[model samples]
Target: MSPTDLGPGGPATIGAAVAHHAAHIPDHPAIVCEGRTLTYQQLHRGANQAARALAAADARAGSRVAYLGVESEWYYELYVACARTGAVLVPINWRLTPPEIEHILRDSGAELLVASEDHLAALDGIRGDLPQLGAVVSLAGYESWRAGRDPADLPDTTDRQTPVVQLYTSGTTGLPKGVVLAQRSFFAVREALADAGLDWIDWQPDDVSLIGIPGFHVGGIWWASQGLVAGVTNVAMPFFDSSVAVGLIRGRGVTTMCVVPAMLRLILREPGVGKADFDQLRKVVYGGSPIASSLLTEAVEAMGASFAQIYGLTETGNTSICLPPADHQPGSPRLAAAGRPYPGFAAKIIDGDGGPVPPGTVGEVCLRTPARMLEYWGMPDATSATLVDGWIHTGDAGYLDEDGYLYICDRIKDMIIVAGEKIYPTEVENALIQHPAVAETAVVGVPDDRFGEAVHAFVALDPGAQATPRDLATFLKGRIATFKIPVRFTFLERIPRNPSGKILRRELRERFWTDRVRQVN
Candidate 1:
């Protein structure tokens, strides 16, 4: 089928899409997790039964349901069930505090929560605070609940434009906002993949995809959706473990995998990763943050030409710009760029005034696409501010080349100016990560009397590796401009990160600038 034909034409709801694919590939392995395998037909039946159970509990069309759990096979089934029932699925981040969970539940107006036993304990701490929470269902008990239900009674297809999921953004500035994604957005992304050369990955019905990222994040959800849409097998890992991931890749002959920079660092740190026979591993798609060029170069040399870099936001359906397999070359300009904008997306770098900027001028990257989120749930003001004139202002400072390749500078908020010179944290962080002792690093601007803001580095040492504050300070002095070198250094066991492996710069700034009144721009 052509790329255009993939857009929201076949199925009105996600359940319908699953059913359609299940009929075509009934006996195909749909999901494999923790030694449990579910075929396409079995997966459909399981989801149908789960939908019936939700329906029996009064989860009708338009109801909002929050799912609190780690990534697992049941998460996929529950998501499918919610899609079938036309209920808005909210997958809570497992790492969130009880207060944070309560806030998300209240903000999303989630009437019901389906949580695993472990995650349910967190809710007990703030159950009294969630006024919108009506009922709690234990996923551990789902099998018992489904045992008495008939799968044949599942709800039929509904409107495709209806909200299928409400993915909460990692709110660095304030409260998290739910990005309401519709069925059409998923279909648009599936179509966009085709334009980005989906065949280059050689996806097949027999291929097994290793899903190591959290299901709540857009990256994880996108990988899961890709498997579902293509009728490929998914080898699910509850959470990312480098040794376990390597074993799965080599043992199961997994064809494709998705990860972030931090996870890739861990995988590369594994002793046997490079030596392992990854015969069937054909692609490693990565994004969520800037990867160091040194790491990318080493990965390409070790893993062959299977590394693809994607640049996108949660609001844009997890893929708007992709560096194709052919472009995974050492010292390639495209590696510095976020690659070209995906098909069906029109992207431009615009100044603060929202007008297009010169080719090399850094500006806020704005995108107009059918895959953009419908709106930020319950925050019309924020939604209006972000989505203007049919374009979504990405709040990212970047530039586009003459050939339309996007070069991300940094988050507009995270950009540092020292003595009137602009410094992107990513640039500084990339340089710091290249140090042998630096396992991870985050660069932020701290208060400075002379320069207005001085660069500060938070460094995490590699296992069995050590470095002193002055050691890193002197090391960076030689590699970067004198003005860009960090004035202060803080050593940590590990850098703070969200579930998707993106660094929490806001958290770092909060701790370092607590005494100051103004924190960020």
Candidate 2:
């Protein structure tokens, strides 16, 4: 088959799509991970067996099945199995703290958890708190567990609108909110592109996709799902390693991939990366953070591939806006744009009052798309506050050019995104405040060369309590994820606050963000 001929028109649901591809391209590679490849037929049979295993574990329709592991072929099998069994797949970020992990399990009411061996200890730490959890299956034994079950296909229990994935986004309330996405979120954009006869994001028959991002995040899962729905081979990285990624591209003949700016930087820094043969790489789609113009220029020259930038939140089903390759002109003023909305998607800048602003105006960016999340799982208040009238109120400050290209200038929300992981300042502060030496603390994002942003904290200590950055970091070790801990702690007499007692984070962030074109790195 010709490359573009395999673009779209697959089954709408993920499970059905896998089955369709297995029947048509049984011997074609479906996934490649850690030097092992699973053909479409193998993937299909594996998912069928996994689905039977899930049923044996008592997972039913709408039951949440959590997976706490890195990117692997097993993750996809379990993910597809959940889709077939009508169970919601709740992918837990293994990097999170035990308390945070416990909260997700308890909140999602996950009946079963599939954990990697490395994370079994962490799971045990919070196992007592998750009363709803009925079974724990180790990734090391996944094969044995599935081998005893039937490999026959399960009955279709899901539709286009059935919720299949639940991704958690950090909340300002010092907790995480589950962003529930339906099956349509995976297929809507592709169907739209097919119907419109537009090839905004190209797919191919022989395309090999490298998924370097973690499967726990929306970007990684969305990228992998796109490749699967299009019947392309996907290379899944268990964990991202710069040198390993460069090797995979050349060895696997990767045709297209997606990554964040931070990852792109590391991949470029690999020894002899520039001289490497990347002629097989057709396109590189990057997002989840901003990119510097200089780096973009360097990447273009080195990789010799078309580059596209996507922008959206988990609530918008990962990407509602896309900056196509056509506008990646060297020295073009549109290089800084976040890109226009995808076909069948609409975007607008809205004032605080929810009124639409004129073009070239900066305001909160709102998006309306069929790919939008069904709701923030079980949080009616949050769902209503963010998803209003079929629009997602993305708390990002950006404007549209006269040509309709979106330029993200700042973040209206106080959320700090390190690399691509969302770190809420309130969550960090809540952890730091537990230290006896800490009187008050405020967290903010600082410009980082490697990561797009790093967490920085302004601290006011108790009188004569005595503490250093190291002391605070040590205290926060088990209380929060290492990345969420502050990289720099500025001792302050007091954290500056307004008369109403709200923190003036913008004031503290000024020293780092001053003179930058955008407040966000």
The alpha-carbon RMSD values of the candidates against the true structure, listed in the order shown, are 10.7, 1.4
Looking at model 1, report the run of 10 residues with the lowest lDDT sum. 1-10
Query: Quick one: best TM-score, which candidate?
Result: 2
Clashes of 1: 0
Residue 121 of model 2: what lDDT? 80
Q: Rate the local accuracy (lDDT) of all candidates.
A: 0.76, 0.89
Q: Which pairs in model 2 have colliding backbones?
A: none
lDDT of 2 by residue, 1-521 (tens): 43234434557589988888887788889999998999888999999999988888999889999999888999999889988878999999988877888889999999999998888886676788778999899999989989967777777778988999999989989999999999889877777777887666779898999997888899999999998878899999888999999999999999999999989999999888764658799899999998988889989999999999999999998999988898899998889898998877999999989898999999999999999999998999999999999999999999998888899999898888888889999999999999999999999999998888999999999998999999999999989988899999899999999999999999999988887988987
Q: Which residue runs does candidate 1 get wrong by more than 4 Å? A: 1-12, 153-155, 193-202, 415-521
State how far residue 42 of model 2 sits from its true place (Å).
0.5
Index of the highest-lDDT prediction: 2
Model 1 pairs whose backbones collide: none
lDDT of 2: 0.89
